[model samples]
Target: MRISDSMRLDAIVRQQGHLKEQYANASRVAATGAKIGAPGDNPVGAAQSVRLQGALDRIDAFRESIKTPKGDLDQAEGALATAGDLFARAGEIALQGANGSLSATDRASLASEVDALKTQLVDAANTKGQAGYLFGGTSTATAAMDAAGNFLGNAADRTAEIAPGVSAITSVSGALAFSASGGRNVAADLDALRTALISNNPAAIAATVSTLDASRRQILAARTDAGLKSNRLDTADAAHQQTQLSLAAQRHAVSDADPTTAYSNLIALQGAVEQAISVARTSLSTMSINKFG
Candidate 1:
Protein backbone atom coordinates (compact mmCIF):
# COMPACT_ATOMS: atom_id res chain seq x y z
CA MET A 1 0.00 0.00 0.00
CA ARG A 2 1.25 3.44 -0.92
CA ILE A 3 1.56 5.90 2.02
CA SER A 4 1.66 9.72 1.80
CA ASP A 5 5.08 11.14 2.71
CA SER A 6 3.61 13.72 5.14
CA MET A 7 1.51 10.99 6.81
CA ARG A 8 4.56 8.75 7.15
CA LEU A 9 6.62 11.53 8.76
CA ASP A 10 3.77 12.40 11.12
CA ALA A 11 3.45 8.75 12.20
CA ILE A 12 7.20 8.62 13.06
CA VAL A 13 6.96 11.89 15.03
CA ARG A 14 3.99 10.59 17.06
CA GLN A 15 5.75 7.34 17.85
CA GLN A 16 8.85 9.25 18.97
CA GLY A 17 6.73 11.56 21.15
CA HIS A 18 5.01 8.55 22.80
CA LEU A 19 8.36 6.92 23.53
CA LYS A 20 9.75 10.18 25.00
CA GLU A 21 6.76 10.52 27.30
CA GLN A 22 7.23 6.97 28.61
CA TYR A 23 10.93 7.68 29.25
CA ALA A 24 10.09 10.81 31.21
CA ASN A 25 7.56 8.92 33.32
CA ALA A 26 10.04 6.15 34.07
CA SER A 27 12.66 8.72 35.08
CA ARG A 28 10.21 10.33 37.49
CA VAL A 29 9.25 6.99 39.02
CA ALA A 30 12.90 6.10 39.53
CA ALA A 31 13.76 9.46 41.05
CA THR A 32 10.83 9.36 43.43
CA GLY A 33 11.15 5.65 44.26
CA ALA A 34 7.38 5.33 44.10
CA LYS A 35 5.51 2.69 42.11
CA ILE A 36 2.19 4.33 42.87
CA GLY A 37 2.47 8.08 43.31
CA ALA A 38 -1.22 8.84 43.55
CA PRO A 39 -4.66 7.22 43.74
CA GLY A 40 -4.89 7.14 39.96
CA ASP A 41 -1.81 4.90 39.84
CA ASN A 42 -3.59 2.10 41.68
CA PRO A 43 -7.03 3.05 42.90
CA VAL A 44 -7.80 0.06 45.11
CA GLY A 45 -4.31 -0.11 46.58
CA ALA A 46 -4.23 3.61 47.33
CA ALA A 47 -7.57 3.42 49.11
CA GLN A 48 -6.32 0.55 51.25
CA SER A 49 -3.14 2.43 51.97
CA VAL A 50 -5.08 5.41 53.28
CA ARG A 51 -7.12 3.16 55.52
CA LEU A 52 -4.01 1.48 56.84
CA GLN A 53 -2.42 4.84 57.63
CA GLY A 54 -5.47 5.86 59.64
CA ALA A 55 -5.38 2.59 61.53
CA LEU A 56 -1.71 3.06 62.26
CA ASP A 57 -2.43 6.49 63.76
CA ARG A 58 -5.02 5.00 66.10
CA ILE A 59 -2.69 2.19 67.11
CA ASP A 60 0.03 4.69 67.91
CA ALA A 61 -2.32 6.59 70.17
CA PHE A 62 -3.19 3.39 71.99
CA ARG A 63 0.44 2.51 72.35
CA GLU A 64 1.11 5.92 73.89
CA SER A 65 -1.73 5.42 76.35
CA ILE A 66 -0.38 2.05 77.42
CA LYS A 67 3.08 3.49 77.80
CA THR A 68 1.80 6.24 80.08
CA PRO A 69 -0.05 3.77 82.28
CA LYS A 70 3.00 1.59 82.60
CA GLY A 71 5.01 4.58 83.70
CA ASP A 72 2.47 5.43 86.40
CA LEU A 73 2.38 1.84 87.61
CA ASP A 74 6.14 1.73 87.83
CA GLN A 75 6.22 4.86 89.95
CA ALA A 76 3.46 3.53 92.20
CA GLU A 77 5.29 0.26 92.68
CA GLY A 78 8.43 2.11 93.66
CA ALA A 79 6.58 4.32 96.13
CA LEU A 80 4.84 1.31 97.67
CA ALA A 81 8.17 -0.40 98.08
CA THR A 82 9.46 2.60 99.98
CA ALA A 83 6.36 2.72 102.12
CA GLY A 84 6.73 -0.98 102.96
CA ASP A 85 10.31 -0.48 104.04
CA LEU A 86 9.35 2.49 106.21
CA PHE A 87 6.62 0.48 107.95
CA ALA A 88 8.94 -2.42 108.59
CA ARG A 89 11.44 -0.07 110.18
CA ALA A 90 8.70 1.42 112.33
CA GLY A 91 7.90 -2.07 113.61
CA GLU A 92 11.57 -2.64 114.42
CA ILE A 93 11.80 0.62 116.36
CA ALA A 94 8.67 -0.32 118.32
CA LEU A 95 10.24 -3.64 119.17
CA GLN A 96 13.44 -1.90 120.29
CA GLY A 97 11.51 0.58 122.43
CA ALA A 98 9.66 -2.33 124.06
CA ASN A 99 12.95 -3.69 125.51
CA GLY A 100 13.09 -2.92 129.22
CA SER A 101 16.89 -2.80 129.21
CA LEU A 102 16.89 0.33 127.01
CA SER A 103 16.78 3.71 128.71
CA ALA A 104 14.90 6.87 127.71
CA THR A 105 17.98 8.05 125.79
CA ASP A 106 17.93 4.88 123.67
CA ARG A 107 14.19 5.25 122.91
CA ALA A 108 14.77 8.87 121.96
CA SER A 109 17.51 7.76 119.53
CA LEU A 110 15.07 5.31 117.96
CA ALA A 111 12.52 8.10 117.57
CA SER A 112 15.01 10.10 115.52
CA GLU A 113 15.42 7.24 113.06
CA VAL A 114 11.65 6.77 112.79
CA ASP A 115 11.28 10.49 112.15
CA ALA A 116 13.68 10.24 109.20
CA LEU A 117 11.79 7.28 107.80
CA LYS A 118 8.58 9.23 108.05
CA THR A 119 10.03 11.94 105.86
CA GLN A 120 11.34 9.38 103.44
CA LEU A 121 7.95 7.70 103.05
CA VAL A 122 6.25 11.06 102.57
CA ASP A 123 8.62 11.96 99.76
CA ALA A 124 8.11 8.57 98.14
CA ALA A 125 4.35 8.99 98.18
CA ASN A 126 4.83 12.09 96.12
CA THR A 127 6.55 10.24 93.30
CA LYS A 128 5.52 11.34 89.84
CA GLY A 129 5.70 9.72 86.44
CA GLN A 130 4.95 10.80 82.89
CA ALA A 131 1.39 11.75 83.72
CA GLY A 132 2.10 13.04 87.25
CA TYR A 133 1.40 11.74 90.76
CA LEU A 134 2.10 8.04 91.32
CA PHE A 135 -0.23 7.46 94.27
CA GLY A 136 -2.35 10.57 93.92
CA GLY A 137 -4.54 8.77 91.32
CA THR A 138 -5.42 11.85 89.31
CA SER A 139 -4.45 15.06 91.06
CA THR A 140 -0.95 15.83 89.80
CA ALA A 141 -0.43 19.36 90.99
CA THR A 142 0.55 18.37 94.56
CA ALA A 143 2.18 15.59 96.52
CA ALA A 144 0.21 12.48 97.47
CA MET A 145 0.92 12.84 101.17
CA ASP A 146 1.34 15.56 103.82
CA ALA A 147 4.41 16.11 106.04
CA ALA A 148 2.81 13.89 108.71
CA GLY A 149 2.28 11.03 106.22
CA ASN A 150 -1.46 11.59 106.09
CA PHE A 151 -3.03 11.04 102.69
CA LEU A 152 -3.58 14.55 101.31
CA GLY A 153 -4.42 13.97 97.67
CA ASN A 154 -7.44 12.79 95.76
CA ALA A 155 -7.00 9.69 93.65
CA ALA A 156 -9.69 10.21 91.11
CA ASP A 157 -9.62 6.95 89.15
CA ARG A 158 -8.22 7.81 85.78
CA THR A 159 -8.67 5.66 82.67
CA ALA A 160 -6.09 5.00 80.03
CA GLU A 161 -7.05 3.27 76.83
CA ILE A 162 -4.51 0.55 76.12
CA ALA A 163 -6.20 -0.80 73.06
CA PRO A 164 -9.36 -0.56 70.97
CA GLY A 165 -11.40 -2.52 73.50
CA VAL A 166 -9.31 -2.33 76.65
CA SER A 167 -8.57 0.28 79.34
CA ALA A 168 -6.56 0.37 82.57
CA ILE A 169 -6.51 2.52 85.69
CA THR A 170 -3.19 4.30 85.96
CA SER A 171 -3.20 5.26 89.62
CA VAL A 172 -4.32 4.27 93.12
CA SER A 173 -6.03 6.42 95.71
CA GLY A 174 -3.36 7.34 98.25
CA ALA A 175 -5.77 7.35 101.21
CA LEU A 176 -7.47 4.09 100.31
CA ALA A 177 -4.24 2.39 99.31
CA PHE A 178 -2.28 3.44 102.41
CA SER A 179 -4.81 2.72 105.14
CA ALA A 180 -4.71 -0.43 107.29
CA SER A 181 -7.26 -3.13 106.59
CA GLY A 182 -9.57 -1.84 109.34
CA GLY A 183 -7.46 0.43 111.46
CA ARG A 184 -5.50 3.68 111.46
CA ASN A 185 -3.22 4.66 108.59
CA VAL A 186 0.55 4.30 108.68
CA ALA A 187 1.09 7.90 109.77
CA ALA A 188 -1.26 7.61 112.77
CA ASP A 189 0.31 4.32 113.76
CA LEU A 190 3.75 5.91 113.65
CA ASP A 191 2.51 8.78 115.80
CA ALA A 192 1.19 6.31 118.33
CA LEU A 193 4.55 4.56 118.29
CA ARG A 194 6.26 7.92 118.92
CA THR A 195 4.04 8.50 121.98
CA ALA A 196 4.76 4.99 123.31
CA LEU A 197 8.50 5.52 122.74
CA ILE A 198 8.44 8.75 124.81
CA SER A 199 7.14 6.87 127.84
CA ASN A 200 9.47 3.92 127.26
CA ASN A 201 6.55 1.62 128.03
CA PRO A 202 7.11 -1.88 126.58
CA ALA A 203 3.37 -2.70 126.66
CA ALA A 204 2.37 0.49 124.86
CA ILE A 205 5.05 0.13 122.18
CA ALA A 206 4.14 -3.55 121.76
CA ALA A 207 0.48 -2.64 121.29
CA THR A 208 1.30 -0.38 118.35
CA VAL A 209 3.39 -3.10 116.62
CA SER A 210 0.26 -4.71 115.24
CA THR A 211 -0.85 -1.39 113.81
CA LEU A 212 2.45 -0.95 112.04
CA ASP A 213 2.28 -4.48 110.69
CA ALA A 214 -1.18 -3.84 109.31
CA SER A 215 0.04 -0.66 107.70
CA ARG A 216 2.83 -2.61 105.99
CA ARG A 217 0.32 -5.04 104.60
CA GLN A 218 -1.62 -2.18 103.08
CA ILE A 219 1.42 -0.93 101.21
CA LEU A 220 2.22 -4.44 100.03
CA ALA A 221 -1.27 -4.87 98.71
CA ALA A 222 -0.99 -1.62 96.81
CA ARG A 223 2.23 -2.89 95.31
CA THR A 224 0.48 -6.01 94.11
CA ASP A 225 -2.21 -3.99 92.39
CA ALA A 226 0.41 -1.83 90.69
CA GLY A 227 2.26 -4.94 89.53
CA LEU A 228 -0.84 -6.37 87.91
CA LYS A 229 -1.51 -3.12 86.13
CA SER A 230 2.07 -2.97 84.93
CA ASN A 231 1.84 -6.43 83.42
CA ARG A 232 -1.36 -5.59 81.59
CA LEU A 233 0.16 -2.37 80.28
CA ASP A 234 3.12 -4.26 78.88
CA THR A 235 0.82 -6.71 77.12
CA ALA A 236 -1.24 -3.92 75.68
CA ASP A 237 1.88 -2.17 74.48
CA ALA A 238 3.06 -5.26 72.67
CA ALA A 239 -0.32 -5.83 71.07
CA HIS A 240 -0.57 -2.23 69.92
CA GLN A 241 2.91 -2.38 68.46
CA GLN A 242 1.93 -5.47 66.51
CA THR A 243 -1.14 -3.77 65.13
CA GLN A 244 0.89 -0.77 64.02
CA LEU A 245 3.42 -3.02 62.35
CA SER A 246 0.71 -4.78 60.40
CA LEU A 247 -0.69 -1.48 59.27
CA ALA A 248 2.77 -0.26 58.23
CA ALA A 249 3.24 -3.40 56.12
CA GLN A 250 -0.04 -2.78 54.40
CA ARG A 251 1.01 0.81 53.62
CA HIS A 252 4.29 -0.38 52.18
CA ALA A 253 2.57 -2.96 50.01
CA VAL A 254 0.39 -0.27 48.53
CA SER A 255 2.92 2.50 47.85
CA ASP A 256 6.48 1.19 48.09
CA ALA A 257 8.47 0.58 44.91
CA ASP A 258 10.63 -2.47 44.20
CA PRO A 259 14.07 -1.09 43.60
CA THR A 260 15.38 -3.88 41.38
CA THR A 261 12.28 -4.12 39.20
CA ALA A 262 11.90 -0.37 38.88
CA TYR A 263 15.56 0.07 38.01
CA SER A 264 15.44 -2.55 35.25
CA ASN A 265 12.20 -1.21 33.82
CA LEU A 266 13.64 2.33 33.75
CA ILE A 267 16.75 1.17 31.90
CA ALA A 268 14.67 -0.66 29.24
CA LEU A 269 12.33 2.29 28.74
CA GLN A 270 15.25 4.71 28.33
CA GLY A 271 16.77 2.48 25.67
CA ALA A 272 13.48 2.21 23.73
CA VAL A 273 13.04 6.00 23.78
CA GLU A 274 16.59 6.57 22.52
CA GLN A 275 16.02 4.12 19.64
CA ALA A 276 12.73 5.78 18.67
CA ILE A 277 14.39 9.21 18.67
CA SER A 278 17.17 7.93 16.39
CA VAL A 279 14.68 6.50 13.89
CA ALA A 280 12.57 9.66 13.83
CA ARG A 281 15.63 11.83 13.29
CA THR A 282 16.77 9.60 10.43
CA SER A 283 13.33 9.74 8.76
CA LEU A 284 13.17 13.53 9.01
CA SER A 285 16.69 13.87 7.60
CA THR A 286 15.75 11.74 4.56
CA MET A 287 12.59 13.74 3.75
CA SER A 288 12.75 14.99 0.09
CA ILE A 289 13.04 18.75 -0.51
CA ASN A 290 10.77 18.65 -3.62
CA LYS A 291 11.58 22.30 -4.76
CA PHE A 292 15.05 23.43 -5.79
CA GLY A 293 16.47 25.47 -2.92
Candidate 2:
Protein backbone atom coordinates (compact mmCIF):
# COMPACT_ATOMS: atom_id res chain seq x y z
CA MET A 1 0.00 0.00 0.00
CA ARG A 2 1.35 3.44 -0.98
CA ILE A 3 1.07 6.07 1.75
CA SER A 4 0.92 9.73 0.69
CA ASP A 5 2.63 12.52 2.69
CA SER A 6 -0.75 14.16 3.18
CA MET A 7 -2.12 10.92 4.75
CA ARG A 8 0.90 10.70 7.07
CA LEU A 9 0.41 14.35 8.12
CA ASP A 10 -3.30 13.72 8.73
CA ALA A 11 -2.50 10.64 10.86
CA ILE A 12 -0.01 12.70 12.91
CA VAL A 13 -2.65 15.39 13.48
CA ARG A 14 -5.21 12.83 14.63
CA GLN A 15 -2.73 11.23 17.06
CA GLN A 16 -1.77 14.60 18.50
CA GLY A 17 -5.42 15.52 18.93
CA HIS A 18 -6.11 12.31 20.85
CA LEU A 19 -3.11 12.87 23.10
CA LYS A 20 -4.17 16.46 23.80
CA GLU A 21 -7.67 15.31 24.75
CA GLN A 22 -6.26 12.76 27.20
CA TYR A 23 -3.98 15.39 28.75
CA ALA A 24 -6.87 17.86 29.04
CA ASN A 25 -9.08 15.28 30.79
CA ALA A 26 -6.31 14.51 33.30
CA SER A 27 -5.69 18.19 33.95
CA ARG A 28 -9.36 18.88 34.53
CA VAL A 29 -9.59 16.02 37.00
CA ALA A 30 -6.55 17.22 38.89
CA ALA A 31 -7.48 20.92 38.94
CA THR A 32 -11.06 20.39 39.97
CA GLY A 33 -10.25 17.55 42.41
CA ALA A 34 -13.06 15.42 41.02
CA LYS A 35 -13.04 11.91 39.66
CA ILE A 36 -16.18 12.43 37.62
CA GLY A 37 -16.71 15.90 36.20
CA ALA A 38 -19.28 14.80 33.66
CA PRO A 39 -21.65 11.84 33.32
CA GLY A 40 -19.63 10.49 30.42
CA ASP A 41 -16.60 10.02 32.71
CA ASN A 42 -18.30 7.47 35.05
CA PRO A 43 -21.92 6.98 34.08
CA VAL A 44 -22.82 4.51 36.86
CA GLY A 45 -21.10 6.48 39.60
CA ALA A 46 -22.65 9.73 38.41
CA ALA A 47 -26.16 8.24 38.45
CA GLN A 48 -25.63 6.76 41.90
CA SER A 49 -24.35 10.07 43.22
CA VAL A 50 -27.43 11.81 41.89
CA ARG A 51 -29.71 9.30 43.62
CA LEU A 52 -27.85 9.57 46.93
CA GLN A 53 -28.03 13.36 46.79
CA GLY A 54 -31.76 13.20 46.17
CA ALA A 55 -32.26 10.89 49.17
CA LEU A 56 -30.24 13.20 51.37
CA ASP A 57 -32.38 16.15 50.31
CA ARG A 58 -35.55 14.23 51.17
CA ILE A 59 -34.21 13.40 54.62
CA ASP A 60 -33.44 17.08 55.16
CA ALA A 61 -36.95 18.00 54.16
CA PHE A 62 -38.45 15.49 56.56
CA ARG A 63 -36.30 16.85 59.37
CA GLU A 64 -37.45 20.37 58.62
CA SER A 65 -41.08 19.27 58.66
CA ILE A 66 -40.65 17.49 62.00
CA LYS A 67 -38.98 20.32 63.92
CA THR A 68 -41.95 22.58 64.70
CA PRO A 69 -44.34 19.72 65.28
CA LYS A 70 -41.98 18.08 67.75
CA GLY A 71 -41.80 21.25 69.82
CA ASP A 72 -45.56 21.63 69.65
CA LEU A 73 -46.07 18.08 70.86
CA ASP A 74 -43.71 18.67 73.74
CA GLN A 75 -45.74 21.69 74.76
CA ALA A 76 -48.90 19.65 74.48
CA GLU A 77 -47.54 17.04 76.86
CA GLY A 78 -46.55 19.75 79.34
CA ALA A 79 -50.00 21.33 79.13
CA LEU A 80 -51.66 18.00 79.76
CA ALA A 81 -49.50 17.48 82.84
CA THR A 82 -50.57 20.89 84.15
CA ALA A 83 -54.20 20.13 83.43
CA GLY A 84 -53.96 16.85 85.33
CA ASP A 85 -52.58 18.68 88.37
CA LEU A 86 -55.38 21.20 88.23
CA PHE A 87 -58.00 18.44 88.11
CA ALA A 88 -56.39 16.71 91.11
CA ARG A 89 -56.45 19.95 93.07
CA ALA A 90 -60.07 20.44 92.11
CA GLY A 91 -60.88 16.98 93.39
CA GLU A 92 -59.26 17.84 96.74
CA ILE A 93 -61.34 20.99 96.99
CA ALA A 94 -64.46 19.00 96.06
CA LEU A 95 -63.71 16.55 98.89
CA GLN A 96 -63.35 19.42 101.37
CA GLY A 97 -66.59 21.03 100.18
CA ALA A 98 -68.35 17.67 100.57
CA ASN A 99 -67.75 17.83 104.35
CA GLY A 100 -70.87 18.68 106.26
CA SER A 101 -68.86 20.23 109.12
CA LEU A 102 -67.55 23.01 106.83
CA SER A 103 -69.50 26.29 107.08
CA ALA A 104 -71.32 27.81 104.08
CA THR A 105 -68.79 30.68 103.94
CA ASP A 106 -65.90 28.24 103.87
CA ARG A 107 -67.59 26.31 101.06
CA ALA A 108 -68.15 29.53 99.07
CA SER A 109 -64.47 30.42 99.45
CA LEU A 110 -63.52 26.96 98.23
CA ALA A 111 -65.87 27.38 95.29
CA SER A 112 -64.04 30.59 94.35
CA GLU A 113 -60.72 28.74 94.42
CA VAL A 114 -62.21 26.00 92.24
CA ASP A 115 -63.23 28.63 89.70
CA ALA A 116 -59.66 29.88 89.57
CA LEU A 117 -58.40 26.32 89.05
CA LYS A 118 -60.86 25.97 86.19
CA THR A 119 -59.39 29.06 84.56
CA GLN A 120 -55.89 27.62 84.84
CA LEU A 121 -57.08 24.36 83.34
CA VAL A 122 -58.53 26.34 80.46
CA ASP A 123 -55.17 27.96 79.94
CA ALA A 124 -53.49 24.55 79.88
CA ALA A 125 -55.90 23.30 77.23
CA ASN A 126 -55.22 26.38 75.14
CA THR A 127 -51.44 25.97 75.37
CA LYS A 128 -49.62 27.30 72.31
CA GLY A 129 -46.24 26.29 70.88
CA GLN A 130 -44.25 26.63 67.66
CA ALA A 131 -47.20 25.55 65.48
CA GLY A 132 -49.80 27.37 67.62
CA TYR A 133 -52.12 25.45 69.99
CA LEU A 134 -50.53 22.08 70.65
CA PHE A 135 -53.71 20.28 71.57
CA GLY A 136 -55.79 21.85 68.82
CA GLY A 137 -55.46 18.80 66.55
CA THR A 138 -55.35 19.96 62.90
CA SER A 139 -56.86 23.32 63.84
CA THR A 140 -53.56 24.50 65.23
CA ALA A 141 -53.95 28.03 63.92
CA THR A 142 -56.34 28.89 66.80
CA ALA A 143 -56.73 28.27 70.51
CA ALA A 144 -57.75 24.76 71.42
CA MET A 145 -60.10 25.79 74.20
CA ASP A 146 -62.15 28.87 74.96
CA ALA A 147 -62.52 30.64 78.32
CA ALA A 148 -65.70 28.68 78.92
CA GLY A 149 -63.60 25.48 78.75
CA ASN A 150 -65.34 24.57 75.51
CA PHE A 151 -63.12 22.69 73.06
CA LEU A 152 -62.72 24.83 69.94
CA GLY A 153 -60.58 22.36 68.06
CA ASN A 154 -61.62 19.50 65.85
CA ALA A 155 -60.96 15.74 66.09
CA ALA A 156 -58.24 15.63 63.47
CA ASP A 157 -54.87 14.18 64.49
CA ARG A 158 -51.96 16.05 62.97
CA THR A 159 -49.12 13.91 61.60
CA ALA A 160 -45.75 14.12 59.86
CA GLU A 161 -43.58 11.78 57.82
CA ILE A 162 -40.38 11.01 59.66
CA ALA A 163 -39.22 8.40 57.15
CA PRO A 164 -40.31 6.55 54.06
CA GLY A 165 -43.83 5.16 54.58
CA VAL A 166 -43.68 5.96 58.26
CA SER A 167 -45.80 8.69 59.83
CA ALA A 168 -45.90 10.07 63.39
CA ILE A 169 -48.76 11.92 65.02
CA THR A 170 -47.65 15.36 66.17
CA SER A 171 -50.76 16.94 67.67
CA VAL A 172 -52.81 16.21 70.78
CA SER A 173 -56.56 15.82 70.92
CA GLY A 174 -58.00 18.75 72.88
CA ALA A 175 -61.37 17.08 73.24
CA LEU A 176 -59.83 13.96 74.74
CA ALA A 177 -57.54 15.92 77.00
CA PHE A 178 -60.20 18.34 78.28
CA SER A 179 -63.54 16.59 77.81
CA ALA A 180 -63.24 12.90 77.10
CA SER A 181 -65.74 11.68 74.54
CA GLY A 182 -68.93 10.15 76.10
CA GLY A 183 -67.61 11.30 79.49
CA ARG A 184 -67.74 14.51 81.57
CA ASN A 185 -66.54 17.86 80.29
CA VAL A 186 -63.84 18.91 82.76
CA ALA A 187 -64.69 22.61 82.53
CA ALA A 188 -68.41 22.02 82.93
CA ASP A 189 -67.72 19.69 85.84
CA LEU A 190 -65.76 22.41 87.60
CA ASP A 191 -68.64 24.82 87.04
CA ALA A 192 -71.14 22.33 88.43
CA LEU A 193 -68.97 21.75 91.49
CA ARG A 194 -68.67 25.49 92.06
CA THR A 195 -72.41 26.00 91.68
CA ALA A 196 -73.09 23.10 94.00
CA LEU A 197 -70.64 24.49 96.60
CA ILE A 198 -72.21 27.96 96.50
CA SER A 199 -75.68 26.43 96.86
CA ASN A 200 -74.45 24.10 99.66
CA ASN A 201 -75.64 20.99 97.71
CA PRO A 202 -73.63 18.25 99.37
CA ALA A 203 -74.79 15.49 97.00
CA ALA A 204 -73.86 17.45 93.82
CA ILE A 205 -70.43 18.27 95.26
CA ALA A 206 -69.82 14.59 96.01
CA ALA A 207 -70.79 13.66 92.46
CA THR A 208 -68.37 16.25 91.06
CA VAL A 209 -65.48 14.69 93.00
CA SER A 210 -65.85 11.47 90.97
CA THR A 211 -66.25 13.48 87.76
CA LEU A 212 -63.07 15.45 88.49
CA ASP A 213 -61.20 12.21 89.16
CA ALA A 214 -62.37 10.86 85.80
CA SER A 215 -61.21 14.03 84.07
CA ARG A 216 -57.83 13.73 85.70
CA ARG A 217 -57.48 10.14 84.51
CA GLN A 218 -58.43 11.19 80.99
CA ILE A 219 -55.81 13.92 80.94
CA LEU A 220 -53.22 11.46 82.20
CA ALA A 221 -54.06 9.03 79.43
CA ALA A 222 -53.79 11.70 76.78
CA ARG A 223 -50.49 12.88 78.19
CA THR A 224 -49.18 9.33 78.03
CA ASP A 225 -50.13 9.14 74.38
CA ALA A 226 -48.39 12.43 73.74
CA GLY A 227 -45.25 11.15 75.41
CA LEU A 228 -45.25 8.08 73.16
CA LYS A 229 -45.57 10.26 70.09
CA SER A 230 -42.71 12.42 71.26
CA ASN A 231 -40.58 9.32 71.66
CA ARG A 232 -41.46 8.17 68.17
CA LEU A 233 -40.36 11.50 66.79
CA ASP A 234 -37.09 11.26 68.67
CA THR A 235 -36.43 7.79 67.31
CA ALA A 236 -37.29 8.87 63.79
CA ASP A 237 -34.99 11.88 64.04
CA ALA A 238 -32.08 9.71 65.08
CA ALA A 239 -32.75 7.29 62.24
CA HIS A 240 -32.97 10.17 59.81
CA GLN A 241 -29.60 11.45 60.92
CA GLN A 242 -28.10 8.03 60.38
CA THR A 243 -29.64 7.84 56.95
CA GLN A 244 -28.25 11.26 56.05
CA LEU A 245 -24.80 10.22 57.18
CA SER A 246 -25.00 7.07 55.11
CA LEU A 247 -26.16 8.89 52.01
CA ALA A 248 -23.42 11.46 52.42
CA ALA A 249 -20.77 8.77 52.66
CA GLN A 250 -22.12 6.97 49.62
CA ARG A 251 -22.14 10.15 47.59
CA HIS A 252 -18.60 10.96 48.61
CA ALA A 253 -17.42 7.53 47.63
CA VAL A 254 -19.16 7.73 44.28
CA SER A 255 -18.15 11.24 43.24
CA ASP A 256 -15.23 12.46 45.33
CA ALA A 257 -11.74 11.98 43.86
CA ASP A 258 -8.45 11.54 45.68
CA PRO A 259 -6.37 14.61 44.98
CA THR A 260 -3.14 12.63 45.24
CA THR A 261 -4.21 10.08 42.65
CA ALA A 262 -5.59 12.74 40.32
CA TYR A 263 -2.35 14.71 40.47
CA SER A 264 -0.29 11.61 39.74
CA ASN A 265 -2.48 10.69 36.77
CA LEU A 266 -2.26 14.24 35.46
CA ILE A 267 1.59 14.23 35.66
CA ALA A 268 1.76 10.88 33.84
CA LEU A 269 -0.58 12.07 31.05
CA GLN A 270 1.47 15.29 30.67
CA GLY A 271 4.69 13.27 30.31
CA ALA A 272 3.12 10.92 27.75
CA VAL A 273 1.74 13.81 25.68
CA GLU A 274 5.12 15.55 25.74
CA GLN A 275 6.86 12.34 24.56
CA ALA A 276 4.30 11.83 21.78
CA ILE A 277 4.72 15.44 20.58
CA SER A 278 8.52 15.08 20.43
CA VAL A 279 8.29 11.84 18.42
CA ALA A 280 5.70 13.34 16.04
CA ARG A 281 7.91 16.39 15.36
CA THR A 282 10.91 14.16 14.57
CA SER A 283 8.86 12.00 12.17
CA LEU A 284 7.35 15.07 10.42
CA SER A 285 10.79 16.65 9.96
CA THR A 286 12.13 13.41 8.43
CA MET A 287 9.14 13.14 6.09
CA SER A 288 9.50 16.78 4.96
CA ILE A 289 13.23 16.30 4.25
CA ASN A 290 12.65 13.13 2.30
CA LYS A 291 9.82 14.67 0.24
CA PHE A 292 11.92 17.76 -0.71
CA GLY A 293 15.08 15.76 -1.49
The most accurate candidate by lDDT is 2
Cα lDDT tens digits for candidate 2, 1-293? 99888898898899889989988988888888778899999999999988898999999998888888788778888888998999899999999999989899999999899889988988898888987777777888888878988888888887778887888778878877776562668888888899999999888899899988988898998999888888888888898999999899889888887888888988898898889889888888888666776
What tens-digit string does per-residue lDDT give for candidate 1 at 1-293? 87788897889878978887878777777888777778897899888878888888888888766767787788888888888889998999998899889999898888888778888878888888887777776677777788977786774778876777666676766766664422457788788888788777789989988989988888888888888888888877787778778878778777787777778989999889888878777776777753334
Residue pairs with colliding backbones in model 1 are: none
| Each model's total of backbone clashes | 0, 0
Backbone clashes counted, model 1: 0
Best by TM-score: 2
The runs of at least 3 residues in candidate 2 whose Cα sits more than 4 Å from the true structure, single-residue gaps closed, are: 1-12, 99-101, 201-203, 278-293
- Lowest lDDT 10-mer window, candidate 1? 175-184
lDDT of 1 at 215: 85
RMSD of each: 2.9, 2.8
User: Candidate 2: which pairs clash?
Assistant: none
Candidate 2: clashing residue pairs, number: 0
**Worst 10-residue stretch by lDDT in candidate 2?**
175-184
